[model samples]
Target: MSTIDAQTDSDATDVASRSNYELIIEPRKGLQLFDWKELVAYRDLFRFLIWRQIKVRYAQSAIGIGWAIIQPLFSMLVFTIIFGNLAKVDSDGAPYALFSLAALLPWTYFSNAITDGVQSLVSEANMLRKIYFPRLMLPLSAVAAKLVDFGIAAVMMVVMMIVFQYPPSIQIVALPLAIIVMLITASGVSVWLTALAVQYRDIKHGMNFLVQLLMYASPVVYAASIIPEKYRLLYAINPMVGVIESFRAAILGTTSIPWDLLGVGFLSGTILLITGLAFFRSKEKIFADVA
Candidate 1:
């Protein structure tokens, strides 16, 4: 056989023997919505990013995960003194420490998630440039990493509840739902802030102040009952309001479930998630270029 024919036959045999695997790349046109299928296909990358975030979070830190418990625990103490004692803030009949800690758990998670998620892209700029993967994974992993901290801090909250003699009640059944709401809310805000942070670095600088304001705006140190009845619905528009209130009710066993407020929070959080996903996906194409 001719050398050229033999080479052609060899190439054909190699192609036929290889397993069928194909990847296509195309220039995206217009706004790209969230593609769960693509995200699922890249699940390994997502898991790796999450693991990297968790490792980086505790790396070189002497105390490591202990920082998680310390942050909210100390914040709860200061709030207990200033708001619980000095200002005489009401806690809906629950002990001030327990009340504040309940709210702080979700708040700390939300705030850290946003703060880290916002910087996830910028911080991983080298990876962003070196390889191609779902840009959403960076921010999503950042938010997910906070769950570890949240879990650690939660143990302290349980210990605090025991110290305060607060027992979980039927409302505790809704704790998972409340936590989902918080995650959705935090993920929405994180994606939005992360997309923006890619273009404007100033977003990172303003985050601390923004988080502080949001905490005060939320029911962290004070009870939702303190808000007048008329403005209660308006207050519920803030997603954290319902989340924090629900946590207090579930963990501290204080008030009954606030279905109306929770509904409002769900609605607002849904809107944020949709809009934030749209914005993030829209900006995703340019991330490598910008980052």
Candidate 2:
């Protein structure tokens, strides 16, 4: 073969090989649920996003991450005084401060995750317009960032448990499940709110109201036992009710497993997650234009 012809054949072979390796990007049609492989491929980007969120949150604040510990601690104190002393709310045989703090650990994380996650896409609008990555990463990173705050607040919870002389029990084995429940519930709501916030700026204000209402609706300031048995199942649909209750049961070693309520919470959270993902995916295509 002539050298030119040989080179032409080699170039054609290279073109064929490159075509096989080409990645095609196209607009998704109708409720495409998840892109697991793309998400996995972007794992490094996801990690960086989570880290960036954590650092940016406390970057220039005077108290920095200490806000995490202080916010929940102060809230626990007020609840102890108001609900524990005044209202005479029951804490299921544990100290009110400890009870409230246990619930607050998960509650604070969830609230913060949703509040920040809802705003993540809008806040990162510059990046959204300029770059391409999994839109899920934005809200997911926001929720993941609160885990740092959760960890910090949790240490204070342990300290409170020691002060109250409550030791860890075998039930502590369930703590991971409790945390996972909180994460799922938070992420699910965050996904829904984040997607909505992009199209409706009013959602940001409504979110504040929703979070406050949810706090009261859940058992944050009181015990689940105070909820009527007949209505307890209805209350468990809130997801956080079981999560906060389970936290106290596992950590404070107070109540029983409350399997029925926990089951309701898990089911509700799973449904929220599926629906939220579907909604987020449907709206994701327009994020650049709307965000």
Clashing pairs in 2: none
Model 2, residue 245: distance off in Å is: 0.5
lDDT of 2 at 145: 85
How does each model score on lDDT?
A: 0.90, 0.90
Count of backbone clashes for each model?
0, 0
Q: How accurate is candidate 2 locally (lDDT)?
A: 0.90
lDDT for 56 in candidate 1 is 89
Pick out the ten consecutive residues of candidate 2 with the lowest summed lDDT.
22-31
**Please, what are the lDDT tens digits per residue for candidate 2 over residues 10-60?**
999999998899678788776568899999999999999999998888899
Model 2 RMSD vs true structure: 2.8
Span of 10 residues, lowest total lDDT, candidate 1? 27-36
Tens digits of lDDT, candidate 1, 176-291: 98999999999999999999999999999999899999988998888889889999999999999999999888887788988878889988998998899999988887898998
Q: Estimate TM-scores for all models.
A: 0.92, 0.91
